[model samples]
Target: MKSLCRIGHSLHSRGLTFGSSGNISVRLPEGGWIVTPTNVAMGDLDPSQLSLLDDDGKWIDGPKPTKETFLHAAMYGARRDAGAVVHLHSTHSVAVSVLEDIDPADVLPAITAYYVMKVGALRLIPYFPPGDPALGEAVAGFADKHHALLLANHGPVVAGADLRSAQYAAEELEETAKLFLLLQGHKIRPLTASQAAALKQ
Candidate 1:
């Protein structure tokens, strides 16, 4: 709980999350999960009030989970190794999501080795209204192959083997997005496909 709170505060303080624009979840080893409640600022998550769910993803205790809870649930369902998930309406990532020319299959270029290593190939999930089941389904379809996804016109969602891993990957994604935006309209040299594949390997 403390770790989750710390991440929430870090994200908010660093401007990755503004207002209540993000949701986070961590899978419990025994079963089920804990997720941040809806409409609460990530900077102010209260550990005692975190929502708890059963293996089925039903809210069993504490406040109601994020309306976007399905996103987290979909990720967990698709990736057994994903111990935590972080979804954020971060600035640069959202900016990149709305770009007309980005490839939906892999939204970000392999601009840096750390970005390639931490986020791998970032996919795009088509736009859907918040809480829409279709969004969850879209995420589920891609979650199996990619741990990081950019929600069309929304933001990014990332999953990792643990909370810290997820958090770091999410941060790395936002930084990469910022870098991508800065380099637009300029001659650029992204790592070759071979280079990116090597990092993944």
Candidate 2:
């Protein structure tokens, strides 16, 4: 448990994550989930501070879970293939959220082969107040078509088959967001639809 907790925070100190702004959860092999507690910095997670919730989203045991628990619950419900969910407020991604007058539907592109293959597709969900149920709707809107999502004014969230994969995807998002920022002044060529499809194959 401590090990998992550290992975959450390490991303913060390393500058890939920050601001008590992210949450991580794993579906225990037996059942239920182990989630980071609310308002606690990911870097500061303690085993005792972790919350356990039943599959129904009820507190089976442990401290109070995050108010955003519903968002996590929505992911679990929408994605049977997901074993872990990680949410992050990485700086560059949040920064990109407000820049580049790109269309909402096409915010994510196959600009990089790695992003195309690793993330498949990225969706942008409209902003909702933190801890609001509306966030679940924004997230759910993209769940059927995307594994990664950028919250309008918030951050990014991803569901992976496992924790490592989830973390990796989160890292990839930050990298791409950084690229999106750095390339702001340049002419960029997005991957053609056929090229994007080839990578999917």
The whole-model lDDT of each prediction reads: 0.94, 0.81
Candidate 1 achieves a global lDDT of 0.94
Using lDDT as the measure, which candidate wins? 1
RMSD of 1: 0.7
Candidate 2: regions farther than 4 A off: none
lDDT agreement of model 2 with the native = 0.81
Put down candidate 2 lDDT per residue, 1-201, tens digits, no spaces.
876687887887898766677889888888899888888888788978899999867777887787788777878878888888888888887887765586677565567888877786677788788888889977877786777888887888888899888888888888887888788778999888899899889
Total clashing pairs in model 1: 0
TM-score of candidate 1 against the unseen true structure: 0.98
Error of 1 at 161 (Å): 0.2
Candidate with best TM-score: 1
